[model samples]
Each structure stands twice: as C-alpha cells, then as structure tokens.
Target: MTNEIYMTSKAWPFDQARAILRRLDIEKKRGIDRGDKPVVFETGYGPSGLPHIGTFGEVVRTTMVRNAFIALTEGKIATRLICVSDDMDGMRKVPGTVPNPDELEAYMQKPLTDVPDPFGTHDSFGNHMNARLRAFLDSFGFDYEFMSATELYRSGAYDEYLLRALNKFDDIMKVMLPTLGAERQATYSPFLPISPSTGRVLYVPMKAVNPEDGTITFDDEDGTEVTMSVTGGNVKFQWKPDFGMRWAALGVDFEMFGKDHQDNAPLYSRICKILGGNPPVQFVYELFLDEKGEKISKTKGNGISVEDWLKYAPPESLSLFNFAKPRAAKKLYFDVIPKTVDEYYQHLDGWSRQDEKQRANNPVWHIHNGTPPDENPPLTFALLLNLVSAANASDTETLWGFIKKYAPDATPENSPGLDRLTHYAVAYYEDFVKPNKAYRDPTDQERAALEDLVKRFRNVSAAESNDGEALQTMIFSVGKDHEFENLRDWFKAIYEVCLGQSQGPRFGSFVAIYGPEETADLIETSLAGNLS
Candidate 1:
C-alpha cells in the first residue's frame, strides 16, 4: 500500500524513468505472456582490465532504471538485474595497472580465466578483476547477481546456447560476415574454438563445424588443425553473437550501453532477432572524459579512481555525477568533484523544502533511490570549505565550535549531515586547500574590485549579513563587477586571492556560518597580501 501511494503520488512521465517503465510494461506483456518468461536486465563487464569509473557508471545507471521499473510496478513485477563478468574472454593486451607486462606476453590470447593472477592473490587474473569489481559495487550498496562466464561455460550453463549456435552456424555467419572487412570475411566464423592442444582460445577461422557431432575444426596458431567439441568449455561464440545469445537465453528485457558500442547496435540487434530474441529496450549514454576530453579507460587511467573519490566525497555525490545529464559526455575528474558535491547538497536542501509531489524531479529523490532524506545537511560543501579556514579548524570539534557561534542552534546530534562534511572538508583543506594558500596580488581591476566588494560587505549591517539569501546576492553582484566570468570563477578568485586555492564552500553560506565580522577580516587579509 505504501509502495502504491509512493508510485501514484510522483509525477509519472519523468523522461528517463517514464521511458524505462513504458518499455518494461511492454516487455511484461510481450515477453511474459507471449514469449513465456521473466524479464531480465543485464550489464556486462569485461574483466580484461581492472574495473574503473566507467564500469561503475554502467551498473549504477542500469540499476537506477531497474529501480524505477520496480517502483512503478509496486512489487507486482518480477525482474532480475545481473552483472555478468566476461571472465572467459581472452586477454588481447595487458592492462596498464597490472605488473610485468612483458611476462603477460606469454599469456596473450589465453582465456582470462586461465591466466595466472598477476597480483598473486586470486586463482587467476579474471578472478582478481572480478573480485575487485564485485567489492567496488558492493561498497556502493548495489543489489545484483554476479555471473561469471568462466563458470557459465565451464559448468555447461551456456552449453545449450553454444551447441545451438554451432548447429545454426550458417545463419549466425550470415548475420556476422557483412560487418567484417574483406580480409576478416574470408576467415570469419561465429565460433572461437578453445584449443585442446595449446589450451588457448583460438580466434582463427573455423575450418568446419560437424553440427551432428557438435565439433568445430579450426587451425591453431602453430598451423596445426584441431577439432573440438562445441560444448563443455571447448568452444564459444564470438562477442557480437555471444551478446545476442545471452539476451535470448537469459530473457534480457532492458539494457543501457555506452556510445562506443553505438556502431555495433544494429548488428547486435540483428543477431538477437536472428536468434529469435528481441533486443531489450536500450539507451546509449556518452562516455566519461578526462579534462583533456579523452575517454576514461582502464588502461589509460585518465580519470579519478573509485576509492580515491570516495575518500573525499560521498558516494551520493558520485551517483549525482552519473545522474547529471548522463546523455552528454562530461569530465569525470577531480576538478568536477567539488561542484558535484555542492550540487548534491543543493538537492538535499531542495528536497527538504519542496512539497512531496513537487520533488518528482528532485535529484535527491533519485539519489536516495526514490526516498530522499528527511532533513538537509546543515552545511554545504562550499560552506564547510570556508569554515575549515575561517576557524583554522584542523579537527571536527574546532569546526563545530565555530559552527555553533554563527549557527547557534546547530549541535552535533541534530546536524549529522554536516558532521560528515566536516571531516571531508578538513581533509580536503589539508590535501587541496592549505598547501595552495598563497597571496595572489589581484590585478588593478581585481584589487579595486576586491576592495570595493569588501567595503560593501563591511558596510552591510550584521542583520543584513545574517540574511543568507541577501548576502549571497551581494557576493554574486560584486563578483561580476570584479570581472569574474561566472560564479565559478567568482568563487575561484575568492579562494585563490583570499583563501589561496581555486575553490571553497558557498561564499554566502560560509560567511553567514562563519560570521560576517570574520569574513571582513579574511577579505582584508587578501587585499593586504597576507592570505598565507
């Protein structure tokens, strides 16, 4: 009953959520009644490299859509979300993260499941990568079933599908051949025979397939011909065909992939159709890029690592980053983290004040998996950044002491949200802020602007400064007058010229929380070349 009330109360027809629910409804009617099965949602991970931010983005976004479907169905729907690791895949190249690259040359083209663990921890490289992937997602509290292709094929879970693909070899080949280059077309086959001689997965063109006996003949790297059974870990479908086969056998109803796979969409769909399965309702999101605008990669490691970001920011902020305009390619680097954290705080503030029905579009609602927090964090990330310096606080107690002075009503017990930010702010200050605190002699125009802005701030009555909204407005107006292009730079100057870094908390909130009198002194210090 509670679920129904929650579902019916929110605005339906939310862009992504509505689209997901609509497609899920169609799948239930078509696949369950007509096609005869439960709906499945699957996301694949290539365990060839250590998992990175992109890996998490896929799982988080897909789970979000799955959660929305579950909400709209009000527990009446039965669906499963699975994260499948392609641990059976062969390693084409060694990942940059792994050690002894030259050592792995010997293992090239070997199934990842067969390669030795480079770290000497897990049974194989695949298991090591899979363990890290699972641990990372578990840290974020995702609910998912983990499937290993190594186990799936070795245990014969994919045996029936493998044999069927072999039997229908000609049909699968017809769907795959046109996509290959002329050179590839001549040797193209839908199956890679796992060599019994070298115990390696051979990608060489299949010489023949004895469908009646379910054996595949292929040339080994040494120019020797080998025939192997299509079942029992002896052979596997090539990736495109393998993807479609998973959907057919597993009953996948929905999937979301990155744009790098966009070119393969048509081919994948045709393969799924040829296999008598409908490709799930799909979305292709853009890739995550570094500040240089290059795609983030497991080997390149161009963007922030998962555990590193979690160290300074909340997981919810990372979730917000993923949720924010996912269709557009965005920088997934440290420079984006402060802004994402501030945005998370804004949503929390919005959620606390808005009427329940109005929060249908509030990100905090989605961030919390549709149930937003009952209270907002007392301090924003930007605000806490200021408190760290204003109070010269090296620890929580000292920070709380300053908070109580300006926000007299705040107490540790009542403001648990701020409590979390306090720790992050202090650490961030030491790591990112404190070391960079140096005096930047403002340009004549910048110096004039800073002086005038401080004058206005000093001239304001304590009562006016006490008004949070009014003080923030003054800060923005003065920022533009000083030649800052945007509020971002406005704060950047405030931190760089005044606090000695490129960022800090929301200026107005920080001033209000830090007391207007202390803010005046901080500004004076900046103008006097004493920011250090």
Candidate 2:
C-alpha cells in the first residue's frame, strides 16, 4: 500500500513549542521505560462563540504538532488531537450583531444550554455555536474526538475529580480571591453555599442523581428551596475550580488557548497543581486583526471569518497562511491575501530547489512533513486562458499572428518578458478570481509606441519579410529599442497601450500555447478601443 503524506511535521518554526515537545517526548519515553502510561498532547476550545481565524490558527497548529509526533514515530507511536467543547461555560453577555441579541444577556451567568442559538435550530445557543465549530473542523479534515461539557458532566466521569477539587476549593479560592481583581478575597462560593440568617456563609452539599432531573437544586440554610432546573447533571461546581478538575479528569496532556485566557492561565495552573494533575499544553497564541488593525470580536461586529477568505482562495492557500509565522500584532487585510499566497508558494518552491546545503536546517523546509514538491504548469492565468482560446484556432504560429490582427502593422517580436506569468497568475487568482474585473488596458504612451512599431512593421521591404525575426529587426532598427525590466512589467506597459493595465500575461506564449488567429480575433474584439 502507498503511504500517504501526513500533512504534519515536528520541525516547525515556533521554537518554544518544539522545545516543549522535545522535553515531553523524553518524559513520555522515561515513563514508558519505567513501565508507566504514556502522556499525550491535549487541546480544547469553548464553543460559546463563532470559530474565527484566530481559532483556526490555534487548532491548525495543534493538529500540525499532533500529526508531527505521529509522523516522527513512523505511525507506530500514538498521540491524539483531543477536542473538548466548553459548552457548559456561562453566557457572559449577548454577542453583538447576534440575531435577537436582546435575549442573550438574560441568560448571563447561566450555562450555554439555557441560551438559544443564533440560528434558533439547535436546542440552545451553546449547541448552535458548538455545532458550527464542529462543522468547521470537520470540513478542515481534522481527526479528533468531539466531547461536550454537558455530556461529560452528565456522564459522572468527572464526579470524583470535581469533588476532590471542591474539597480544595476554599484554599484555591483563598489564593484566587485576593489576587483576582483589584479587590480583596471578597467574592466567595463553596459550590453554592448559602448565607445563614446570622449572616455567616455555610456550605450546601449537592449531588448528581442518576434518575434525577438534570438541574441544580439550590436551597437556603433553613432548608427552604430556592430553585432547580439546570442541565447536564443534577450537581455542579463553580467555573474556575470546575475547569481545573475537568482537565485533570479528562487526561489532557497539552492544549493551546487564545490570548484572552492569558490572565486565567495562572488560576487554572494553580488549580491543576492543587488537584494533582499536570496542566495540558497551555500555550496562548495571539488574536486575529481586521483590515484596520483592530482585534476582531463578534460582539463588535468587526470579525471576518474563515469562510469569507475561503471564497477567494483555495484550501492550500489558507493552510499556507496558517503555517506562516503567527504575528502578535499584525493586521490582516483582504488586499494582502493574494500576494501572501503567491509569496508563500514561491518560498516553498525556493526551499525545494536543488541546492541541498543552502538551507539544510531551515524550519520551513520541514514544515510540509515531506519533501517540498513543485506545483506545475508554471503559466500565468491570462496566458493560460489565452492559450486555451488560441489553441482552438485554425492556424498556430508566432504570437505575432494574434498581435498582427490586433495591431495589423505592429511587430509581434516586441512582446513583453515571460518571467512574470506565474506571479500574475497567483495575484489574479488570489484577488480577482471572484467577480473578475475588465481586462487591463494600455496607456497613451504605450499605445503610441505600439502604433509607431506597427506602422514600421508594415513598411518592411520584401527582403525583410521572411518571418517574425525579420519583422523584429525592422522594428528594432526604427526605434531606440529600450529594454523592458521584466515580462510582466513590460506587458503592463503594453497592456496600458493595448488594454490599460499595469500587468498581464505573456502575449507571445498566450498566442503560441493557444493559437494565432483565435488570439488575434480576441484582441481585435477586446482591444478595438477607439484605435482610429
């Protein structure tokens, strides 16, 4: 059977992550050598909001590292991409721009299960967001185990862990209480304790019933019932300690989080240590920026999603963007998307060039998990399209055939360079692939030059009428014969005269690859712009 390339690798550019992995690998081997269970990397996300581009970067990196470990072991060793959804996280505030945002704030400090999804199809808002993120990951081809907090809570798997953490909740809370905000250790909760008539806080024990209704029953110290009707389980704990207990109980080894969680990392870490479990991969990546350099947030109605970018570029291009260095504070705009994609591929191609010793230790060289491969056809899009159209023509000769029909007296030998066909193809596809604009036209100077060249070509004597070479020499002799900087640049100049654009495909290759008269007809029709 053929071995499929695992699209992941270990030698990534992020130095901190790679260093952590190396240590973890040693630890895992040492445990196994000592006849102990092996530890794996673990990651999770809260499904309270839409999975934005920032989320994509974090998860993609996680997947890349997970696959890298697997590839490192030649598929014999094992690692997992553990995806936990914090569906139990409370609704803080109604995110902005949500359809019917008024109702969300009502569910504040309540489990996500209580809120309705924006789409209103799911049982609750939490379910809707979770489902959307799950769909995005699935479409992205991620292999993972999807676990929801609601189900996990109801399963009783976290019962022991939650109780243990709750026993230590006082000490943990004491540490967090004083250090949390600017206030003292004032706010307190021992798994829903109640204030006595005398004003003393007392504990109120709760239990998750097997056949009991899935809701937390709150009561006063005097035994008067307050309320009931929680989902997931009959028992529950506060947020901070609960998350710590959940990680320990879930056997998560590593997980990266968003920058928003940076402040909470210490609290969670303390909880994990207190509960006798290692914190999972606790890296915090930066956020994504909009065109104006502002952080994108659904509440602000300023976020651009992955689905939006995917409409203009292919998946590979998206992957390329993900693999690029994660900037802590750089803004991403739609205008930069196309150029970045081309530069990414071009860099990959350069890395794969035949110089083995040039960049032997380069991180990007190993980013692809396998030897970097070339993407073929190396032809620009306009040229390719022109080629396709010309290829169907009756006669195939010099690109001059098409040029001659477009500018009957012009010499085709004055064509622009061919080096930029690939670059133009990339830019055009990345930016102009959707809702294509009109053809790039030529400038007045370029048009005058073409007119002069065409007139000279027609006046060529019979002795110089052998082929395009003779025509080329005649045109060259009549003018100063200024050299074009490059093919695309020159074409841009020619196009300004012919079509009015700064860049375009190689006319010669287009007509040659395509055909002569067909290309000529296209030019005559497309470029007949007031050329009296």
Number of the predicted model whose TM-score against the real structure is largest: 1
- TM-score of predicted model 1? 0.87
TM-score, predicted candidate 2 vs. hidden true structure: 0.65
Q: Write the per-residue lDDT of candidate 1 for residues 181-212, one digit (tens) a residue.
A: 99999988878877777777777887788878
The 10 consecutive residues of candidate 1 with the worst lDDT sum are 4-13
Question: Best candidate, lDDT-wise?
Answer: 1
Residue 103 error, candidate 2, Å: 6.7
Candidate 1 residue-wise lDDT at 284? 87
Name the runs in model 2 displaced over 4 angstroms: 1-10, 13-21, 25-39, 94-108, 116-121, 182-185, 188-244, 301-303, 344-375, 380-532
lDDT of 2: 0.54
Report every candidate's CA lDDT: 0.77, 0.54
Per-prediction TM-score to the true structure, in the order listed: 0.87, 0.65
Residue 405 of candidate 1: its Cα lDDT?
A: 70
